[model samples]
Target: MGAGVDYIFIGDDFTGASDTLATLARAGRRVRLFLDPPDAAAIAEEGLDAVGLATEFRALPAEAIAVQMDVLAPLLKALSPRIVHYKVCSTFDSSPETGSIGAAVAVLERHLDPALVAVMGGQPSLERYCAFGNLFASGPDGQIHRIDRHPVMRNHPITPMAEADLRIHLARQGLQDLLLLAWPEIEERRATLKTHVDELMRAGKKRMLFDACDQGHLETIGAALGGCGSDGRPLLIVGASSVAEALSGDLRPPGVAAPAQGSRTEGLCLVLAGSRSQVTAAQVKAARRFKPMPIQPRHLADKTAAGAFAASCAAALAAGENVLAHLAPTEDYRCSGAELSCKLANLVAAILDRQTVCALGVAGGDTSSIIVRRLGFRSLAFEEQLDAGVAICVAASDMPQRDGMRLMLKGGQVGSDAVFDRFVSAMNTKSPTTPSGLWRHHP
Candidate 1:
């Protein structure tokens, strides 16, 4: 088949890919989305042509990976887009399947020109809770480096590389106005980040971006360094679960409850707690305790309910109605099997229908990882931050039938205070009606 489009979004889940497409569409780019079979209608409703791929679900990681590759091969061959955008998980290294990256890369190599494939690796863990730096860079050699110091990075385990080494790497890549993303897990590392940012500025780096997933940090950083991106561009920071904390000014210490009657908006809050059953339970309990209103909980295990909810939410959002979506797996805690796969396909399909979801949230590590993968991303990974905190994603819908959604990956054990705060804040700052639909949700 002849090449039919200019861009291909691979690896992201229904919600994320749709949101990204919404963002791109807002920028006036004509894009075609390829998602799993179940999400085709959501894509079609959004006025974008979407193709679905068939594959096996819930097999061993290796086997499942094979199925993914086999299904995507034909679509890649047929579309032949100039740009193949892979929305990869940042925490792939932590997954059971060791060769996911290699396998995914191999599949892409066969279908698209390697040079044209740009991997947008989103850090799901760092996006949920407060982290020290905005963004960090890791080279192919496995060395880690950062662009600025973030308080949360202090005393963390993730290693930090020398600023000089990072600079050398970037210079070698001939990357100008480049953004670096990293999870700085120690005090020394945070210091190193500050130094790096200063050095990069001194070196005349035009644009520097970081991932600040928490709200308080965003404001603090915003105050400390006014004007986001260099040269008048908003510095891009991926704010995750802590987005609510930043927005609602509720970055209180864990266990400290905010007043019972606080002003908060109604929207979906996705609490992404990896497979820890206890963590998921706590989030449900916490939501009941702190929410401004009685937030109804919907168990998504029922495929029909899950799918219908997803579709209704998408359609509502497309019609310019504010929506709050909180997607958590069932109490059974089953993922990565044939049954789970089918359920996920339905959920994703629902989300894809309405690209611009007003406020979206996801919890659970495995759930986060799987969702990220479904979005057509290739290199990003999700790490555990704060034991378990909710990651928050926020996006706006400007035009009818298009969607822009943001993501915040929160740890399960993290307090509900931070999660709720960030969600409210994101809703408050949503962009009003604009010409193009933009999917500016940070995952």
Candidate 2:
């Protein structure tokens, strides 16, 4: 490897991290996403071009984020890779008090002391775009709307976007004075991009945002990032998985084909949909092979009721029926998403203790983070791309029936309506590469 690790990314959530892992691995880059901090052996893994750390950062407050970064800064500094990417959501729907992107950058900058800090906007693959320093995202209606007016994100229960101008939105979160390198500059084939960025750095411009809406735009952004940075100090980048997409073209040589597809996993599969997003609700409605198990937030509050709920889910799977556990569409969950996630995780643990499933699927950003963390998985590797934002990952763990399990982790807004049905069918195949392990009866 050129360096111990060529690129490093810290995802704001588990779903985003898995997506980025898929993006990089599909590009033929050797990479791993660790749920916890990697030890020396992990960093020293042979032939790996990139290393990523997936966190529940998107669910944490500034103080909690700072505390976690304290443990991570030293290890990250030791890698000293060419890039340290603070990967965030494409919609950039983060709040100052919760999942504060600016607070995180401020902390990381103090520790890593990067030569430059930049934000790469727009992941066209996800239908999120940036123009004139304003963010936009596609809605369920397939209409591109400014982020603030985005149908789904506007009403997002947490960290909703209300400002389309990224500068103002970020300033509220403490990331101030961002210089925009708009799309026009990127479009004109301005060969001076790298040179201009260096000049901006010299002028005390600590942070910059690069606009992108297409693959060509990403190429320009990547070219600019590729040219900047010192020998020992890597540039710090913040954005979605598009950061990895851009880097693939700029840093890695071409002709790295994706790995062969694994075979479908056989036997029963368990899916948990803890998101209230309309996308997930639609997916749940469209599922046919999976028996719908509606979970109410109130049902999880009482220990007795939660135990009974878990038993019911186990019974369905035990009866040879694939189970799709989702939040009931009826009531509003007055609890925080984190609270709901923990409760849902408990159900997964309980079900696994009673029934062995070939694969596990979880929908929801916060729910995936909490459940995967609780599942005791050491690392997640790119297994397959089931859909646009949906990645089927392999879980490496030392726990019962978890090792070599395939995980379909998706954000609420990711995947098509038939994603759950597809997940079940994908795992029901007889292929060998498909993991034969997942949640099994512990006894």
Candidate 3:
């Protein structure tokens, strides 16, 4: 119900709403985000007169789509947003259900004028927009600009032509000057990113901006930049969720250290796992011997512990430590998508304010796209479709104050051992780090 609010972000998860709100807020817009399903209690808690649905359509089965529409239709009529922005995923192709767009549009059409609706996808698909010219440019403010202009704004899955017309609508909004930070791809991504930085600096924009395509992107950016914050110290934040999963058998590796406790203290890793089933004395023994290095772990299965862990990771990142966060799915744990996303966005905003570089993330299940787009990278095209496996994404702001972060979503069936090794190896090899850092030994 607040006045002068220009944007209302709705997502199935909190991170998307939070990220979009943060970006728009930084740009001096009055934004309110609704991260959960619209209900009387949630509406009262957020004190908003408007709402946006941020859920990804593909996450639901085709049979459920109609049911979802039945629920959303009334909600749209009740909230009556000036513009209903439906967030889409360029990488999602599960279930052959035509995904979230069609489902969202179907519901919105029942209550609002179709002219008031807009559809947007995150960073992974930035190239899909024809407006991307140099991939690298500098703004007059001495800031690097990765401009994006897409041709599709309102295309439904059922109607392909709506996408083209949507582009015309975007052009009218004066979004042509909108600049985005580009992620490094192949050798050229980094080079292109670096070139844009140089151009921005030459134009008098010397502040390093961060935006990651995934956690790998964050690690890659962190590694390339030598893991130093603006104050010139090594980034030492922990990836609590990943660490937690490791302790819980969700991330078990063959050589992983067993948990250990001294006479006066219990194993920190065991305590973090917080699962009576997963965190046993034997598991603790195994955790103590894990190679590489050990991070402080948290109990993600426990809602209270997970919230605390998320908060702590955010705090560390805000303090300029390189942090990784892991999230278990709703099915595996009690955490909700909206709650997790809100916590992440809050932490990212805090880090940005400190000007300390850090990464924010979520892992496990279908959480990657929701979290990554929340941070504002337009989605990119994936080489292969994800098939009941892990989905990892990283989102970073171009500004050095905000550390680039990753969201790694692994599936239940993926072996924890292989996942951890591959994750660490990938991060170490791709991330730029000092000679004395963990990544230094990586081949």
Candidate 4:
């Protein structure tokens, strides 16, 4: 906290946070992500090059996001990193009512008082691109589509992406007046790009968006960003893990850097899917190794019903069968996503209370955040990359039973059809000793 750390990122959810963690750690940078804000002593003790605070704000109302940021502002200020990165989902999933990225930007800008607000608009490594202020992503069907029209995102149960233009989308959330530097501008000479940025800054631009058509664009954008605030003021950046990818640029040469797989253990592997995304539904269906046990929506509202369901999952695990507890895809929930996620977390907690889970997998960002918090994990170290946007993590937890438990978290839209099957196999693959994954801490 004495200013050695160059960057501090506040991730909107656990999955995105770990993606950023992977980007930095794989870059050979010493990084650690905490479940909550750690004290300066902890920061100093970790000898971190970058620190992160993983949050569940992406599932909250705008007012709630503001409240959370108010609590975090002081801790962020204490770290005093050269850059304060506010990491949002790569797909830029949000709405005016919930997970408002614009609202978050406004709050952080006022509190952190950075020289400028720069939003990195693409994560090309994941094949996500931003051109002319529109966001596009590769779909499971092997075609790129505007995020609003993408098969999974268009019909997202919550925060359905109705618009592909980020400027239009964010304006609805009160973040208008953002200046844009298109892909062509990004591809121009570095000095020319700087001149454009300077002109905008001189004209009183506080927030600016840059287009990154590919990984090269992200690096060029990152190289330009790396030179930001050399005048000694901290730069406030916003985006997904690509922000880290951009910042680490040429400093750390890129490589495959696959995450380390944990040594297999002997207990049952449990999977919980609280997401209703088509991607998740397919993963659940294809995960043949696990006995599927779908929870009805009505049962989520009734504790007795939920308990009975948990009992069944516990029974299956005890019989040496890996169980998949998921919300019925066709069932309509009478509760909010947050509420239903809480119910799912409660069920998972109950299962942990009754069974010995050697490995666990949780799908859905909000669900993973709530379940991990309920399980009392204070920190997570990247263990392996189960899929794009999914990281198998080693839990550094306060709960003795859960300490060092191998867990995997996947965003609803992330992973493939066979993702769940692969997760189970990864957990089942035995190794002689704990793999030399990235180092992590609980305190």
What's each prediction's TM-score? 0.39, 0.93, 0.33, 0.91
lDDT against the true structure, each candidate: 0.36, 0.82, 0.32, 0.79
Q: How would you encode candidate 4's per-residue C-alpha lDDT over 1-443 as one tens digit per residue? A: 36456888898998788778766766656677789888777767666768889999898899999888999887877766788899999898899889998888888878778888887787887778999999998887879999999987887777888898888888898878778889887887555666667677878997888888888787777777776766656788889888988887542233233334445565678999988877788898888899999888756888888788888899999898999988877888888888888888888999889897978899989898899888888887665556677767677887788887888788887787888888777777664223222443212
Superposed Cα deviation of residue 391, candidate 2 (Å): 0.5
lDDT of 3 by residue, 109-174 (tens): 554443312122123212122122122212223343333211221221221222222223233322
RMSD values for the candidates in order, in angstroms, are 13.8, 5.0, 19.5, 3.3
Error of 4 at 46 (Å): 2.0
Best by TM-score: 2
Residue 339 lDDT (model 4): 84
Whole-model lDDT for model 4 versus the true structure?
0.79
* Candidate 1 residue lDDT tens string, 352-407: 65453334444433345455445443221111112223323222234342233444
Candidate 2 local Cα displacement, residue 156, angstroms: 1.5
Task: Give the CA lDDT, 0 to 100, for residue 72 in model 2.
Answer: 90
TM-score of 4: 0.91
Off by over 4 Å in 3: 1-6, 12-16, 38-56, 90-95, 116-360, 363-365, 368-443
